[model samples]
Target: MPDKPRLERQAMCDRLAMEFQNDWIVNLGVGMPTLCSNYIDDSKEIIFHSENGVIGYGPLSQEGHEDQHLVNAGGQNVTQMPGWPLFTMQIHSL
Candidate 1:
């Protein structure tokens, strides 16, 4: 059988992002999942949630323009969209 062509990073990310619908809250995992935010349609009102407590964020920060306060689970700085909220999770000792 002929070897199948593989999707490039951005194309793969775009394909994964297409699964989300408008007004849905999406939790982005570490690494490549973060890239999905950039592929979402502008018309959709998808909310990006980071495990570190950022909610309703935009996309990954461009080079040299990172915000010191916003970050995802993987420590990559991300962009803040309108109505972004911050929160903290407390772990209760068992």
Candidate 2:
């Protein structure tokens, strides 16, 4: 049996980030997807959307410097860009 090489978490995130173009609004999921924000290039203007209703956010916040009121869908604290907004998520009865 042959062992397959795999990309590490950060490497995978970096690869994923390269696939996105500038000015695209991207929705980041929990876990690895959330890490992609840290890899996006500075020259690109990609909007990150979180299921928690955070829109236009920046990268994940460094530990101990997290904003108490800002979090991604994964419940991890994240950094906010200019004009970022938090909205309420509503569920309607089917």
Candidate 3:
């Protein structure tokens, strides 16, 4: 097989974290989009609102630490906000 190039997902996330401002309320879409959340700055007030009701989803988990039961819409297990709420639907999307 021939060698190919690939876009580093973690690098993309780092950029998002660097670029986002404190007041941003960003929604990380499923797949590559969701990786953006990792780039967020901790000092800033950027909130990653997952559709599943999670407010401040934490950093991406490492292998072996993943729990299938607590996965996001992207099917990746994520960290949760301290007082994050859980729900079934998004009323605003309507």
Candidate 4:
């Protein structure tokens, strides 16, 4: 079978990132959704949220720099923004 061409993951992320507005708060799920954080426009101040209690985090971590304790819902390592808070699931009720 012939190999089908496909958009690279980064390209896909870039496309989706364009849809977000500056004041929006986005919650990303596992897999492809996690990649969206990497392509967010720098001029915009969109907040990235993770199901695993991470808010205002940056993109995925670089190779050799993974933080075992800082993972997204997908279990992929993520970078936390300065002053980003980690809350328990119970906090959502308040």
Candidate 5:
């Protein structure tokens, strides 16, 4: 996929991110929608709400710091920002 132009991906992700940034409690579906959480700028302070017993789930884990047990439904591990919250998804936006 490295051969593919990154600008297209950036543009697509950016478009969706902008649409959701102003939304409160966005109920994002899975797949590409899940990837959109990574595009929001830090200044925007967008909180990524995830299932798998987490609420404030941040970006995907950096290289070599992955926790296999702490993964989303997609089986990819995620990183948690400082002061982020965790909760049972069944109790929240299910």
Candidate 6:
């Protein structure tokens, strides 16, 4: 059996976060994309958008403090930024 080497998830996220501009709006997907929030440069005012109607949310919530009402597209609890509005979509059919 042979062991395979893999890049640390956080390290990969830190690297990917560097590719965006300071004021860019990023739509992060599930899994690895979620990790990018924790590594983005603090100096940069990057806005994170989730498909689950979350806008301007910060990194993932800590254990035991997860909000059941607040979750990402991946169904993971997320923390919202101050003054950010949560949008919900309604579908109308004829």
Better of 5 and 6 by lDDT: 6
After superposition, the stretches of candidate 6 with alpha carbons farther than 4 Å from their true spots are: 1-5, 88-94
TM-scores, in order shown? 0.83, 0.81, 0.65, 0.79, 0.64, 0.77
In candidate 2, residue 72 scores what lDDT?
Answer: 87
lDDT of each: 0.86, 0.88, 0.69, 0.86, 0.64, 0.81
Ordered list by TM-score, greatest first: 1, 2, 4, 6, 3, 5
Backbone clashes, each candidate: 0, 0, 3, 0, 0, 0
- The deviation in Å at residue 43 for candidate 4 is 0.8
**Tens digits of per-residue lDDT for model 6, 2-84:** 98788898889989989878878899888888877776577788898887667888777999988888877677888877677
Give the per-residue lDDT digits (tens) of candidate 1, residues 18-38: 989989999998888988888
Kindly list the per-residue Cα lDDT of model 4 for residues 33-90, writing each as its tens digit. Answer: 8999888677888898889777888889999998898888788888887678876554
By lDDT, the candidates rank as: 2, 1, 4, 6, 3, 5
Worst 10 residues of 3 by lDDT: 81-90
lDDT of 2 at 28: 96
Highest TM-score: which candidate? 1
- Cα RMSDs, all models: 3.5, 4.1, 6.0, 4.6, 6.5, 3.5
**lDDT (Cα, 0-100) at 11 in candidate 5:** 69
After aligning candidate 1 to the native by TM-score, how far in Å is the CA of 54 from where it should be?
1.0
Model 2 C-alpha lDDT per residue in residues 2-93, reported as the tens digit of each score: 99898899899989999999999999998889988888688888999988778898888998999988988889898989888656778999
- For candidate 2, the per-residue lDDT at 62 reads 93
Which structure among the candidates has the greatest lDDT? 2
